[model samples]
Target: MIQITRTIAIDEGELDESFVRSAGPGGQNVNKLSTAVQLRFDVRNSPSLPEGVRSRLERLAGRRLTRDGVIVILAQRFRTQERNREDARERLIALIREAAVPQAPRVVTRTPFSEKRKRRDEKARRSKTKSLRTGPIHHD
Candidate 1:
């Protein structure tokens, strides 16, 4: 079981890991070993996540989310499968943890009349300054 957060924990079986050839630095071993780890997690089907978290996760995934609501994370920064696997899992956990947090709704705010007046005053001041400079560059 993987503990994503204090309130959310995922079963170990929920994660799907596949190994593929890494294009990252590995010298000659890059050609022979599959060090890259591709981690897939089904966001739509997972029972571990709350509905709110699932929706947020799908949106947060961006290009990583597939058409079927699967998030594919590729970890190839490391040259070893173990490290790549750990990296992939860590990224997945981080993503899930982020989704678990509820986003505060934005509050609509209006500019105060005084603040607006101040801004207008600054704009008028700058405009007058520029207009004064345009009268003449050469004076006897």
Candidate 2:
């Protein structure tokens, strides 16, 4: 089972992993070893996630979520397939955890009266400075 948070946990079966050759470092062994991990999870079909959480996950996933509603994550940072797989799984868990939390609604705030007055005073000062730069009009 993969635990996203205290409230959310997904079955291990929900995660699918694929291993491919890693591109960076590792000398000749890099060509022969399939150390990279590709992890896939179907957000739409998962029975564990609430509809609200699933929707949020889709939005939070960005490019990771495919058109078919599958979330794919690739991990190639580690040199061994097991480490890469673990890394991918951990990333998926982190994503799910982030999505599962409800965001607090932002409270709209009004500018303080003092702040408004200060801004107005600043503008007035600027206007006065600019006006003083002009030569007095000759009334002849």
Candidate 3:
């Protein structure tokens, strides 16, 4: 079982991993060994995640999530397949943990009186400076 958090754990069977040839500084190993790990998690079909977490995960996944609601994480940073696989799993857990936490709602606030006054004073100063740069008004 893959534990995302204390409350959330997904069975190993749920995660699908595919190996593909990696392109990098692996020399001949890059061509021969499929080191890259493609981790696919079906967010829409997962019984482990809560509805809110699934929705947030979908949004966070962005281009990584397919139309079928599968989140694909490509792990190619490591040369070894095992390391890459571990990296991908860690990333998946981290992403889900992030989704699990509810985001604090932002509260709208009005500008303070002192702040408004300061802004007005700055604008007045700028206008006065610009007026000084211009030639004095002449009465014909």
RMSD to truth, every model: 3.3, 1.7, 1.5
lDDT of 3 by residue, 51-92 (tens): 999999999989999999999999999999999999999999
The order by descending lDDT is 1, 3, 2
State each model's CA lDDT, in order.
0.96, 0.91, 0.93
lDDT of model 1, residue 113: 100
Give the per-residue lDDT digits (tens) of candidate 2, residues 70-135.
Answer: 999999987888888888988998899889988889999999999999999999999999999999
Residue clash pairs of candidate 2 = none
Model 3: which ten-residue window has the lowest total lDDT? 20-29
Off by over 4 Å in 3: none
- Model 1, 29-78: lDDT tens per residue? 99999999999999999999999999999999999999999999999999
Positional deviation of 96 in candidate 1, in angstroms? 0.9
Give the Cα RMSD of candidate 3: 1.5
State each candidate's clash count. 0, 0, 0
lDDT of candidate model 3 versus the reference = 0.93
